[model samples]
Target: MKIAFVGKGGSGKTTLSSLFIRHLAATGAPVVAVDADINQHLGVALGLDEAAASMPAMGEHLALIKDYLRGTNPRIASAGKMIKTTPPGDGSRLLRLCEDNPVYDACARLVELDGGAVRLMVTGPFTDADLGVACYHSKTGAVELFLNHLVDGRDEYVVVDMTAGSDSFASGMFTRFDITFLVAEPTRKGISVYRQYKEYTRDFGVTLKVVGNKVQGRDDLDFLREQVGDDLLVTIGHSDWVRAMEKGRPPRFDLLEEPNRRALCTLHTAVAAAYEVRDWERYTRQMTHFHLKNAHSWGNERTGVDLAAQVDPGFVLGEGLAASA
Candidate 1:
């Protein structure tokens, strides 16, 4: 299952995502974590030093990634012709979680935590060189391309730390996830992004759940309940353990607070349940919808080809994936 964690900046979405990834890895689950956020702090949150956290970022190697995923698909004449929303066709490469593949081998890093390990990938951080020259979406597009070609199934999880606010709506990346956990604090500013995201994704059938962070007491919980209503899936109160991690003294997963730990488990359970409802057809439709939108918008002019041709009418993600497996 592919899961995304999104919310306003400073709302603890990154922290929550790291904890959830650790929870899954410690349970011996097959999981891959992608840091698609502009801040790019998930590696540090996952207990990797700044130096060790750095890897072959997807954005820095976009052409290589595009070439690997395009594979033998006749629709994509060249890697340069493939845009971010280009969906997999009959011969396009499809990736499985934790599998040995060119994409993962080049861009992913193996980080051992408690019971198991997690495969980590980042969208590459925005740098001074990108100043006034590049938009963050260019980096984020690598993640969208990766998701477009990925074929994850049950018993596997791909948790993404997306850019803050409604930025993901700029591309089809928001529709790529099986579930999206919107981490919100109780403040008005915190839940404001939730409202925007809800409005943007309401018609798309996105499974958007709210995770209340830094709840002080009943008042905060009441505020979240009153604001988000039934969309609130779980609440995680303040944790000293997380604070310690923030201070640079990371602890083991077993030492996390029981209540917070339970909250993580609840998130895992909710995401796990979504695998039963995974709809490859809907996924393909979403990809095509955004692909055409982009092609009409700028992808056609940018690549100088009819990008709509990239969508394969005969390709069924579920059927193709099963046969490949």
Candidate 2:
């Protein structure tokens, strides 16, 4: 299963993503946690020290990736010629998770998080070179490219902490996950984000569920329920332990309050349930929609390639989690 956590900034999506990764790891599940957010704090949240958290960002290695993938292939001459989400054809590169490949090690260094049952990867922090530029687009495009070619088995999982706000919609990143947990507080701004996300993704065929966070009492819960209604999947009550952990204490999943633990379990169950509800036709349609939407940018305008025709012919809804590469 590939899950993404997205919400307005400070809505606690990163915190929930870290905790959920910990929960899966503790259960002996095969999991990969990705800190795709530009802020890059999922490392610390996953119990890594500052030094450990400071791994290479995949964005910084785009040139190497292009060289490795294009490798003597006459079709693709440069990184700009490659489509991030298109599957590799004959003589093109294919990337498999945990496999030995030319770019795998560098990619692993950038994406893999250390310690625990869950492997971690970060997109890396923004640099001074990025000032006054939309360089994060390249960073996120690296992540999208990585995931585009990655192959995972039925028992494996990928959890990504996406960037805050509707910025993710700027790229096809919104279409990459099987389930997107949108964390929202019981406030107007929070609910506004939910509305924006819904409007943006309504036609994308992505499964969206609201995870209410920072609820203080019944009123907060009531507000969330009223705003999100059937879309609200679960509520995580405020926790002092989480606050303390953020303030420099070591993160101990075992010390999570009972309510929070229950919420995590509920989230896990919801994700599992999502796999059972398959709609391949809709999935394919949405995939085509985004492919066509970006056709001019990633295809004709640059490489003169028919990008829509490059959509994975074998792609099936829910199959990403049910089959091996």
Candidate 3:
């Protein structure tokens, strides 16, 4: 289960990425949360302290990772080059003000595998230099090799949270992900970005879905979901998540988690079934009925959502594995 989230900035892309990671972590699913966004908020979402990444710095860092793999000890790797992201006036100012080697403290927390899920790497948020010339420059072939090591070598699910714009720097990486979630807010331009991004997918065997995160209403939900394909459409709402960001605190899944958890579970199951339904010939002929079953399952869960809905409904709502997961 390799998952990635894409959407314009502030569309809840990072929040969903973190929520999914938290869920998988709770359910014993090992997950790698890749913060590919240049803004780099995934660490903030996960409540992990990490340094702001400069592409120049990242490119420099990659050189070290490669050299270290070859038995060279680079001193800069230990010097800890990093910067502060927290707004001033916060109480944490004194705790880490002007600290060097901030990378160690302000870096992606490789959360251990607790159950089966692990949020191994939370990354991205590089400076413009990372996007302008250096990130694309390819660090002596080390970047590609390092990326392959992350994608090909992972034994568990990997989730990538990419930068917000088009031009394919990050979207090009979509080909390797097992499943892709195209997130959109209510604006047509947002959905349009998702549509264009979808056109560039060249890889086969990867499933794509649309997630309507933080919708203000149902019209947008139905519009996004009705795009006419086998992909799953998951919708969530505006949450205390915004408040959490303002306060620099992590979202307690217990506090701001959504009613859509079961829906996502159903989605994960649907995707697995869709994958193993095996017999593309049979599936093509039967996809409508298959999709309709999923639609029914999804519809039931969408009916009752209050920021405070109890968990009892989903327990009865689950219908066993979509086809035996």
Candidate 4:
């Protein structure tokens, strides 16, 4: 399934995303981990090296896409291949600086990597970097290459480890996949924030689910149900395994930890079951919403998608704050 991990900052989205990557990979399916949060570091949580990503952003990528698209923007034509940043042996920071003048560059870079579509997608933050990446994506053949990777080549699963709080990937015009999950602490604000995303993504024709991360007490769980309707929401309790993982520590999920192993097992099962999701219709039956202003034009790489029809420039710009948050 096409899956994404989201929540307000420090709600364990990255750690959960990393664990999910291992969980899906354990099942032997190829997984693609896409890091969609510009500020949060999935590479650190996953223990990947930064040197893996070396492409220049904005300066080169944006221009490339604009030129290919026949745009007369001044930044589009003046360029030779710029210096590619070398991975820093730590994937947390790309050798290339983060400047998402045009956010399409992120998508473009991933597409250019041979075998970019793996069973797991280990990617970087979805930022201005993605703008230049967009330039690369303008070419139909390139996009087709990436889309084919997601489709026919079929990377077993796609895991987007998003930055906490608001982010560009999350704020984009339309939801991009089969399942969109909201993860939050059980605090009053957390509950409301979880619902906010659940309700917002639904506005764009995307399925949304709630996963209560670091949950505490029966009362909070009960309140969560009351707030989100309790149908299929999941509760992930506090655990040291998760704590250890957050500090770049290893063997985080020790079976001996009182409730951790059990928690991990239960959470893992929930993730495994997420593949069966088909909830877009059930959740949005009552809301009077339209796709975010530009929700119509965001990535529609999936087959048989007529993206032009979904173009909503205002919606797209409106979402920039949401995406960058």
Whose lDDT is greatest here? 1
The C-alpha lDDT values of all candidates are 0.89, 0.74, 0.46, 0.44
TM-score-based ranking, best first?
1, 2, 3, 4
What's model 2's TM-score?
0.85
Tell me which of candidates 3 and 4 scores higher on TM-score: 3
lDDT of 1: 0.89
- The reply for model 2, stretches above 4 Å from the true place, is 67-80, 89-103, 109-115, 278-288, 303-325
Q: Model 3: how far is 275 from its true place, Å?
A: 6.6
Greater-lDDT candidate between 3 and 4? 3
Better of 1 and 3 by lDDT: 1
RMSD of each: 1.4, 3.5, 18.2, 12.4
Error of 3 at 196 (Å): 0.6
Give model 2's clash tally. 5
TM-score of 3: 0.59
Q: Give the C-alpha miss distance for residue 243 in model 1, angstroms.
A: 1.3
Give the true-structure RMSD of model 2.
3.5
Model 4 CA deviation exceeding 4 Å by range: 49-149, 152-155, 166-174, 252-325
- Total clashing residue pairs per candidate? 0, 5, 13, 42
What is candidate 3's CA lDDT for residue 242?
47
